[model samples]
Target: MDGKNALCRKCQDRLWDTRIPASSCERCKSYVEAGGVCRFCKNGGMEHIVSTYAPFMYTGAARTLVMQLKFRDMDDGLAYLTDAMADALPVRDFDLIVPVPLHARRERPRGCNQAQLLAQGVGVRICVPVGNALMRFRATSPQSTLASLRARRSNVENAFALCGDADISGKKILLVDDVRTSGSTARACAKVLLQGGAREVHLLCACVVWHYKGNEKNGSVAGKNGAAAGQHGR
Candidate 1:
C-alpha cells in the first residue's frame, strides 16, 4: 500500500483498522464480555509483566499478514507491523528489546525468527538495543496445536532459559512477538526474563486473538500506536 510492494491499499487499510476495541480487558487487552472478568488475568502467570500492547486483532487481513511472515517467510509486511508496534510503545526508554526464543531445531528450518525480525525493527524505530537474552532450550509442541489454555501453558513451561552473559539486572525490557493467542507463550518468556533480573518486562505483539461473546464473528482469522494508545495493563 502507499506505493509499497508489501500489501495492496485495500489490504493495508483493512489491517490498520483491525485494532482491539475498548470492550477488551483493561489489563491484557483480550476481548471480553461487558463487565466480565478478564480470564487472562484470572488465570494468573502475568504478574511478572508490566503491560501488553498490540496494534491489531488476530483476524482478517491481520491474520494473513502474520501467516505470510511467520509460515511463508514473507517479510514484506515487517515495515507495516513494526511501524504499528513502535507507535504502540508507551515508554521509549527501554533498556533492551528481546524476542521470544525458538529452539534451534525449529529456527534452523525456518532460517529466521519472525519475533527477532520484529524486535530488530522495533529496536531501530525506538532507538533501543535488541539482544538474544533468552534461549528456548527445550523443544515443545506449538501452542496453536494445543486445544486448551492449560495445554498451551504446559507446552512452554520452563522451556525458556536466560542466556549467559546477558546481564539484565534492573533493566526494563520490551518483549516482542508476532502474535499472542492464549498468552501462555508470552507469560512463560516473561517469567524467565523477570527471574533473570529484568526490572520490568512489557509485551508487544503484532496481533492478539480476540474472543467475542455469542456468535459475533467480527472477521476471518489472519493476524499500534503510542504507549497510552495501545497499552493494556493489569
Candidate 2:
C-alpha cells in the first residue's frame, strides 16, 4: 500500500509516505530545529545516544497506526513501520538489535511485546540478529503518567538489566521502540547496555514525539479508530 492506492485507502494514508517533510537534523529525528540542532537533542541527546531516527512525526496518521498496533493488537501495519525505520536508519553495520522490553506483568496481558515485535521486524529488514538483551526488572509507573522529563527519567531509572551473558563487548547495538518522547526510557536502556560493555547504542523508533509530551504508552488500551483491516500479520 502506497499513499492512497491501497484498498483501505484511509488506513494506507496513515503510514509512511515519501512526501512528508523531513526534519532539519537528520542526525536525531527532530521536527523543529533550533540553533541547528533539535532542542531536545541539543540539551538531552548528544552525550547519551549516538543518533536516533524516526521517519514520521508523532501526530495524525502516524499516531493512529502506532495506536492500532499497540492497543488493538493490529500488527499488519508492522511492515509499514519496518519500511520507515529501515529507510531512516543511518547505518546498517550493527552487531545486534535490541528492543525496550516490557515488564513480565505488562507483557502477559498485552499478549506480545510490541517493541520486541518491532525490533524483530527491523532486524529482518537490516539483516541483523536481534536479542532481548534487556529486561524490565523493576516495574515503574508508565511514562505516560509522568508529567515532566525528570519524572519520566526517574520512572525508568535503573529499571532495566542485562538479560544474560549476551556478549556485546565493543559491539554496536540498536535500541528499538514504537515511539520516543523525552527519551528517558531509551536512555535508561542504553546506559545499561554501555555499562554491560556495548561499544555504542543507538535508538530507532517509528515516530518522534515532538514539542509536546503527550500521554504516550505502548501496548496499552488507547483510542481505537482503525482495526478492520489490521488484525495480525499474515
Candidate 3:
C-alpha cells in the first residue's frame, strides 16, 4: 500500500479515470479515512456521534443544489439529491433513521423538513425505518450565519429535544441531514438523542461542507464542462 495514497497497487489500478480523486484524498487528509470522522468531531470531540459520512464535499455542484433547496421552492432538488445519496452511502444496519428537525417557522411553508425528505429517501434505499425522533424546541439563527465554529456551536446548542414516545435506547441510529458544515447541529441533536438512550448515533448527509479554495476553476467533482456534479457512487 502507498501510505501516501493509502491505496494498494491493485486497488489503485482499479480507481476510475483520475485514479485518485482529489475529494477522496482530501477526505483522507482531513479525517474521513481515519474512520470518517470530521476535524471538529475529532479534535473538539462530539458528545455522542459515532461516525459521519457524505458523498460529496460541499462545493461546486453540491453547493449549488443546497442553495437551490434552501432558497428556492425547488422540491425536485430533494429527489435528485436523494438519488445521489442512495449510491454514495452504503446500506448500513441502522435501526431507525431520524432527520434533524427544522424549526417550525422554516418547515411551515413546505409542510415538512428537507432533512425529513432526505431521511425518508435514505430509509427507503437502505431499507431502514425512519422516525421523527426529535423536534426543534427553540429556533436559532442558521448555523451558516455564525462566523466561528464556537459561535455556531452556541447557536445550535439546546435547539433539539427527543420526540415524545420515541424510543432510541439501545438502537443504532442514523441521523440524516441535507448537509453537514461544522457539524454543530448534528452534534447537538446527537447529544440529546444519546442522553435519551440511543446506543450509537451515526451521521449521514447528501453533502458535507469543508473549507475549500477552488471554486472559480470549478473543481474536478464538477462534471464535464464544469456544470455537472456526479456524486461519488454515481
Cα RMSD, each candidate? 6.6, 6.6, 9.9
- Which candidate number would show the highest lDDT if scored against the true structure? 1
Clashing pairs in 3: none
Q: What TM-score does each of the candidates earn?
A: 0.84, 0.82, 0.73
Clashes of each: 11, 0, 0
Worst 10 residues of 3 by lDDT: 216-225
lDDT of 1 by residue, 10-62 (tens): 88889867877767766566666784446556656355777778888877687
Candidate 3 C-alpha lDDT tens digits along 1-234? 112243334432332222112333222212243334334343544457776666655555556666566656654566656665665654588899999998998788766677887888777777999999999989888554455556767788888999889999999999988766556788899999999999988888776544322321212222222222222111
For candidate 2, write residues 1-234 as lDDT tens digits. 331232265555545442225544544554453324554555555346788777776666777687777866554577777777887776799999999999998888878888898898888888999998899999887776655556667788889999886788898999898876667788899999999999998888887654422222322212121221122110
Give the worst 10-residue stretch by lDDT in candidate 2. Answer: 225-234
Summed over model 2, clashes come to: 0
Using TM-score as the measure, the top candidate is 1
lDDT of 3: 0.63
